[model samples]
Target: MSDDQLFALANALPLVGWLALCLAPLARPALVASARVVAAAMAVGYAVMVGLALARAGGPAPDLTTLSGLARAFSDPHVMLVGWVHYLALDLWTGAWEAEDAGRRGVPHWLLLPCLALTFLAGPIGLLLFLGVRTLPGRRVPARP
Candidate 1:
């Protein structure tokens, strides 16, 4: 597939998990499991794209050791797509974890919706928001023995 096609696929795959998390609170376990599967699939795609990017670098490979080097590496479209897929995979995985954790902690599903939306749009910010939300009074559930 063309890199652009692959990028589109990578972007689309995570939405299934996100939709399940947002729409099906009662199916947390299944949704989380499926999200992990989606993330794993993206990771495999990332590895393949990275390998292709490296192989296609006929001249000096993009250096990854410094900030400037990393920027230069990302200048290559293939490398940039690989990086984006990496972000999509990890962000979806993190969202899955957040959903499961929030469900376990007794946080209201309504409260979690915004956090999930934030996470879908901006990964760490959504996580930070969820973390803060979990700490609110009356949200905590006692640990099970």
Candidate 2:
């Protein structure tokens, strides 16, 4: 397949895992079934995307010491797609952690679902939103006298 097609495929792979995560333990009983999805995606999907990116000429030779340098490094379509998948893996991992932490803290499904969805869509925004939600005061346990 052409690099454009490969890029499209790379983008689609994470959506499947993110959708699976939407049915996370916090929201349903099928959580266990999808638990492996993100990790597997990270392992397989990331490798494939990175490999494709490296296939391009000079794709990995950028200085990468500054923002523009990083941008130039990823100017190649394949490398750009690899960069996207890199975000996907990091975002999904963070979303997974957020789900587990929210579950432990008794955050409601109504809230968690949106947060997870947002995280899947925009990595930093969702994490920031969830962190804000986490600041809501919870019932305090009494101290022993």
Candidate 3:
């Protein structure tokens, strides 16, 4: 497939997982299952894509050590796709964790949807938001071992 097509696939994969996760409060099992499956896919996909990016005819790999270096890295299409997928994988993972934690705490579905959205938009930011919510005074239920 073309690089652009592959990039679309990479983007779509996480959205599928994220959508399942958004329904976690109603179906914790689904979220848990998708979390595991998506995590596996992300890992394998990243490894494969990294290999491709390294082999592709393009500029050097992203220099994450500095802001300018990082920008230069994303100038390549393959590298950009890898970076996007990286975000998608981590964001989904974060959202899955939030769903599990929220489930344990008995947080309402109403609240979790937005948190999931935020997580999808910005991985750590959403996690921080949920952490704040998780810490607020409320009835906390013990999680199943």
- Candidates in order have lDDT scores of 0.87, 0.69, 0.79
| Candidate 1 lDDT (Cα, 0 to 1) | 0.87
- The C-alpha TM-scores of every prediction are 0.91, 0.75, 0.86
Q: 1-145 in candidate 1: lDDT tens per residue?
A: 9878988898899998888888647788897888888888888988888787777768986678999999988887778889999999888888888888888898899999999899989999999999999999987787889
Q: How accurate is candidate 2 locally (lDDT)?
A: 0.69
Model 1 / residue 8 / CA error / Å: 1.2
Q: What lDDT tens digits, residue by residue, belong to model 2 across residues 83-133? A: 776777788777777776666666765787778878878878899888887
Error of 1 at 99 (Å): 0.3
Best by lDDT: 1
CA error at residue 109 for candidate 3, angstroms = 1.7
Model 1 bad stretches (over 4 Å)? none
